[model samples]
Target: GFADGTLRLGHLEVKASVLTHDAVPDGLTKLDNGDSTDGQAVYADTAGGQVRKVAVEAVLGSPQQIAPAGTAVVAADYRLGGTEERPEKSFVTVDATGIGRLSRTESRTNMMTGEVTETLTSSVLPGLPTGVKVTTVIMNTAADMVLVADNTGTLYRYDTHNFNAPVLAETLKPLPEGVTLTGIRFLIGEQSIVLTGSDGSVDVYFRLPRDNAKSSDGYTLIRAHQLEKHRGAVVAIDASQRGKMFVTADDTGEVWLRHSTSEQTLLKLKPADINGHYQAVALSPRENEIFAVTDGGQVYNWDIEADHPETTLKTIFGKVWYEGYPEPTYTWQSSSGTDAFEPKLSLVPLIFGTIKATVYSLLFAIPIALGAAIYTSEFVHPSVRAVVKPVMEMMASLPSVVLGFIAALILAPVVETWIAAVIISIAVVPTAWLISAFLWQLLPGPVALRYGGWPKFALMFAVLFLAANLSIAISPLFERLFFAGNFKAWANGSVGSSLAFTTLLILPAVVGILYFVGERVLPSQIYEIMRSPNRTIAGVADFVRWIITLMVGGIISWVLAGLLIGVGLDPRGGIVDTFVQRNTMIVGFAMGFAVIPIIYTIAEDALNSVPEHLRGASLGCGATQWQTAIRVILPTAMSGVFAAIMVGMGRAVGETMIVVMAAGNTPVMDWNIFNGLRALSANIAVELPEAVKGGTLYRMLFLAALSLFAITFIVNTLAEIVRQKFRKRAAQL
Candidate 1:
């Protein structure tokens, strides 16, 4: 028997071939008188005619269907008592007449009738009981006594040596008013008789040994304490062959096991939809198996088995105090070598990976998508806008798998090669616009007044192109100055070096340029909207001074943080080895590429959907184009833009092949931008096909899918709330 839903069986032994006349007679056979339990007729053989031990087995009419039609022999096993050194065992058989026994028997195959031919020995009961017919027999070979219950509920014990002239040892007293005996079993170890009566009750009669001087009969029988009974009349009673635990079956088809030492029911079973008295009950020697048979030959076997440990809740989701660990940890390792390994199936890491991917993707996509959308709607010439809008909208149709392939095979290598160049580009690209805007005003008054928005943008693009090359070209200078020949070596080896180029030139330059353009360089009305309102600060003038202070202060703080993080990276004295490649940078850029078109298309459409008259009114009232776009159109379309960003976010969160190929599939918990992670969708795609059906790993994969669903649902719900708030603000505008 197994908890994994399987049963193991041994080889079958044919009863007739093993129980032949010549073979069984030479062995220690039971005193073949019809008793109770399995009718095991014989067990062992001794060299001489002096067998010391015997075993009872082979119950006759066990299933009731096996009972022969004509004059056939039926067997029951019983103990005939033995010396202190050995216990004597035997079997009892019955014929058509009534309950009878056989001291000897011969069985053979009848050629003509094709039936087992049986011959009974004369060494049996000389005559049947007289005056009252006996219902059940129990033999106590220790005191050479035989017990019997008659039809009138009278119990009698007789000397086993004499059959015809039986010496009666006791005449039992009457029972309760309406009680009638239905079944009986001998409790050999307790020297008691267990009786199941008509009124769903069980009573025990124990034999007490008399002192040698008191009487020649040496023992007296008396009624002992009664136990809890079945709800209906019990039809069969039995116990483990060598145990004190007993079992009973009632008319209602309920079976229960109870110990003779106590009245407590250890186990109970009631099969559904079948209600009738059981004909037989047998407890296996192992104490874990029980068999019940009805009169119609219906047989049922029940077994007790234990479950496998993997399904326990503690092993699935709970934090396990794993061996060899300092503290309990939430881990999600599903399998490893060794049978004793306990699986750690924590969902925390998967959830963290999902959030990390979504966050990085959003950070990379939102600014670029929204900026392009703003340019096309508010600044671009209509002819160019028509081409720009449709082209970006078409990009939305590119397959994500193709994008993932590009990220894995192309983008990761490119980023790894120009790692510093890329970081410089983020700051450089924005400065291009500031520089170009400044350049437009620096032109001669005659030249500036002639061309409008189109020529200004062309200058902006030229500055952007030069700035991009400057960013890439300046990377080597920054590396040599601050990074001791290589930036990767500085990151992977040590912390202190010369001041970075970004620190000496780019930082102060960007700070001065942005601050001046935002306050003193641009229009005063723009300054009025952006500057602090407190008159104590003198508004715009002091605001510029404060801005310079903040920018310089912010740059210093950023450098300090970078140095601190660099120091912490070394795990031992002067050593750090893990290189940064194919990490969050690759995943962010690649997923951002996949996400930008989605966001840009939707956002441009949303911006286009806003009423054109609002823009015209703002411009007609003498507001600059930037002021009109910022103060009017953007706020009105805020809700739709938020929705577009969320849609891109959903795509980022569920992306598989891109992150799977680029994110390294490392199931670790770390937020460092240069490290990789394992996302849930990637894990599922990688593991599901390898998992066995109906196994623990297979179920865990399905659970991971469910976790992804829950994350998406929660994100969408929160996004909806923020969208509603934006919609309300747009209404006010």
Candidate 2:
């Protein structure tokens, strides 16, 4: 195995064994008699991982002549003891150049004179939560190390640099028998500490130097503010930037605002309203705002500027005047808006937008939905009804974003081009229907049966198609005929207003159409009720039409008035507001279509449930099937239809997504269908993400949510009451 062809491994081993000499200078040793030599010797201990003592001998022959292959020996010119105590009590002995060779025990040494030192003992409190142990210890920015624990409240502090090692640091005992710390915060440039305890109390303290002779604990406890408005354990605390004001919340969901000198109850809630046990509080540094979170997971933000934080309604008495009326002595004005200050989330605009968007949508959809619903439910074959209802209802479930994209992208442009055509069709198509019926009557019986009903459907589509296409094809012609120039320009020139009005001019016509459809679809009960009161069909129709017209008209007018009254209805502003308003087109469609299945299912059931003899008796009285259906079946089913419509209205008013996406996000006061608005749910959804957590915007979103919850609750309550009333009425009949 040797490259040199000399198997020298055993020769060297035998030479080393025979090389024992008499106190010899073997293994390259150097003696320092009375002179000095530069050398080093390293030794390793055979026992464990420790070192107890070391002694050095010298060896020299230039740097290259060291013996034992790698060992170096040098004279020991000086010696120094270790400065600090070691945690282990065991040690190992070493010789020459700091290498251990055997096990030994030694006392700890002092750096200055090499003397023994003793270990110190520290105590820590017990029974803290699991995983809650102290890790960091510090007094303040530059103060001595003090005990700090994880969230579970263990304590740690230290006495000196030697104590700075976490293992050597002392853990502070819990507060004396009568007290426990609930909150802790460093304050006043980190020189003072504030501690909050149970029973609405707080203590301030400052750490003094260890050499201080004043107190045994080397600290002074100062009574800062013992706040008591909180009902239970103070679960949360927050302070303003200057520390001039602080707020606290307790388990009961009560909040208290405390100044350096005094305290005030900020808010308190009933157990049911507390929702979540209060767990956290925060005060905005730059604004007069307070935020609190409860264990139940509800968060609330408050504007602390108000004296009465819990009051929902604030009103002021003011003198008012009305045109052509006696001078007003007093009028109640909402304190929410006064002297250039207004509630940030005013419900007026939002309410208006909700109504407007619903009205507009219904204007567009009711004719389609109700007309479809009526035809499908009343005249269409059973198979066709099955197909048609689901298709329409399926549209309800379509993601609103898709519809919105269509409206903003496809429909908006289409409306812009075919606006006049659409208007003309609405006016012309009905007349065409009447004229076509007259022509059909002139046909022979066989021709009529062959062509009447089926041809009517085809003719209906033909007229509509002609109107729509011709309107678009001849839009310029109509525009020239009506305005003699650009219609938008002419509208702007006449009204001296923005272009939004011109674009929205079709709004009134659309509302008229919605009003017509909605009125025409009035539940049979309403018609029966009117007829039972001796009202003729013409009279009933007129009344219902007037009601629908006014409702739709008022909505449109309110938005227009918004323009007249210094509120602009631009897309960015009014479009959003219109969608947020109540009674919007989407609301109407949702409400109306929602009534479809209910009215059909319930009314059908009620009709079927009626004694067959009643309908047979009406027929026996020589009544036609239509008359029997009207006089007996519908009259008996009146309560169910009423109940169904009421339920549908509640559902429509409360649905979040359709309203949120279709209703505009502006909170405006206009009721115009053409304008935009945000509903309570829509407002919350749109703003929740944009709102900074726990700020006014965030709390406003909550308030909107609460309002929506309340509205839905009230609507359902009212619907139930109305349903009962209708039931009683039907029973009387």
Candidate 3:
């Protein structure tokens, strides 16, 4: 098996040759190929259809071999391809001072006597301390990487095949309690370092991705996993052809099959069955047969056909049975918090947070922005509208980071203090605006004409002033009635779990039935009443409509409240307990502020662009200005309005800095406006830089961006479809 052989498949053929090198007489001297004496070339290989011999070393005199003070352990000659016209090769030797590279060599002959002699030279690469002895070295010449470990249990890595520099170098850190490192092994297919500790503990450190690592940087390990139940010092470790699954032996002669990532013991071999302290362990290249030799000269082969780890659907999508928890639960922990903590990477909560943040931002932004656009575009006098529209448009240019700063620092505190007042303003502001408009409509003709029309500035001031007074008056009433005179106490209260669960199941069905009845039955009956022109009949129809609307609204509120009943939660108290300083309220307001101007500018342009003749014709037909604006102008511009809204949403979804700074960035699943959330954009801003290049986290960040792209594509496509439909409908009109 050690000799060269030939293999064939169809017309293709492969020739395998066992390489060899020069052997000197000194016992301390080493050869590139072990136990081979009839070979001539030490660094010759057929690659890319050419022969390479290290470009021929320059030597003025006979080359001398390096004889170190201590016995050398391992020497490996690697065939490498490179940034050159052909492939090359390099040899490495590990001795007292650690990895000495065999850089150049020469052979000398005395021509007079026709005698020849061969000598090897070496170069001591950088990234190792002086006066240290290297116990083992691995050269990945194909990857241009070198790893060396010293007797003191310190391991170092170089970013070059020449072993000249360190990209990131440090001693093994954060070792477990009362354990000292005893040995190191290149494990998991030469991509990780396995440190064996005195207490039978093995720690696996995956190579960190270098910045320059290109496509498919391979797999990387972030945290170190300590193998379980290792009682004695681990004497040796070996991997199967499948790098993730491996076997380890302790000084006590017990052997265990384990996984490198999960660090779970798969199978065990007892000392009585294996017979001696295992000096070496190896897995067969072609089969699942493991061959182990003990110091007592006993050889044993373990046929492990089913060494693969077991998994099921529950381990992936369903609740996981963790080691210490009493019951299985959904979790999303990524790192090992402690040595005992399992790595859990669930996606449920994160997805929920992303949707929740986006929904809150849109809900807060749309109505206010659309209303403002409508009013400014239709009602305001041209002279005033020009000034107001530009002012609103300027808001789009304000940086999001500045908006986030203000939201987090200035606005959150203000809203938190006037929390009850803020809620009450929802009712008070509209009431005040309606009352002000009524009062203005009742103004005398002479006074209105003197004021250059309806006086929007003064009208808005009256509305705000009255709304502020009404909000302050009702705020205390809300506190006394619903919040027990303490808003914060109410905000923190939780609904009972059993009640929440019952409602979660029952309410949806009830609501669906109600919706079905409303859609199929109530509208048909209402349409009959709406066709009548009699005053009393119309009033009756309006009252019925309001009644249906109120019923639907109340049921929705009840269902939302029922959702608060969750596992171990108390649902008896104030619904407002969910509010927090940097919660969805802050993010919604900040992101909405950042988005509103975009919608306003585009919508205003669309609304204003409606032909003036349409307005004139509606007015001439005895229609009120508001009626004509809504029925004619808005309908004609509906396509543009929808496009405007979609564009605003796009900005909201992609807006990063404001949400990053204002949204507390907690990846929680709850949609309560009082709780903080994490968005995909904000998550990228927060996590992307901390991730290692080409690592899982790094690739996941790109996935998040791709998800954003997909969302934008879907939204835009839908917007276009709706816009086209509205355009057709308007053309018919």
Backbone clash total for model 2 is: 70
Candidate 1's TM-score reads 0.53
Stretches of candidate 2 off by over 4 Å are 1-312, 315-343, 359-374, 437-460, 470-634, 731-733
True-structure lDDT of candidate 3: 0.63
Residue 237, candidate 1: how far off, in angstroms? Answer: 34
Per-residue accuracy of model 1 over 186-217 as CA lDDT, tens digit each: 76343556777877787766556646423236
What is the overall TM-score of model 2 with all chains considered together?
A: 0.42
Residue-level lDDT tens digits of model 3 in 1-733: 0011111112223333433323222233233443312233223335444323322233333212443433443433343443333223344555443444533333456768857654344565565677667666666535455556665555555555333433433344335655555666655346556667777777766555445443133323334456685777888777756445677888877777876654677778764665668898776664377677898888877887643242223433456534333335544554444432344443445556666766788888888888888888877777778888889989998989999999999999999889889876865686577556545544564675577434657769777987898898888986666566776765565322234323432444565566556757765667667445554464456555545655674566456655545433434332223666888888889889888898888888989988889889999996767779888999999998999989988897787887777778777666577878777788778778777786545665676678778878998999999999998987786
CA lDDT scores, all candidates in order = 0.65, 0.47, 0.63
TM-score of each candidate structure, all chains considered together: 0.53, 0.42, 0.53
For model 1, the local distance difference test gives 0.65
Which is the winner by TM-score between candidate 1 and candidate 2? Answer: 1
- Candidate 2 lDDT, 404-471, residue by residue in tens: 54454555455545555654565456545544544544456576556544455567678777656665
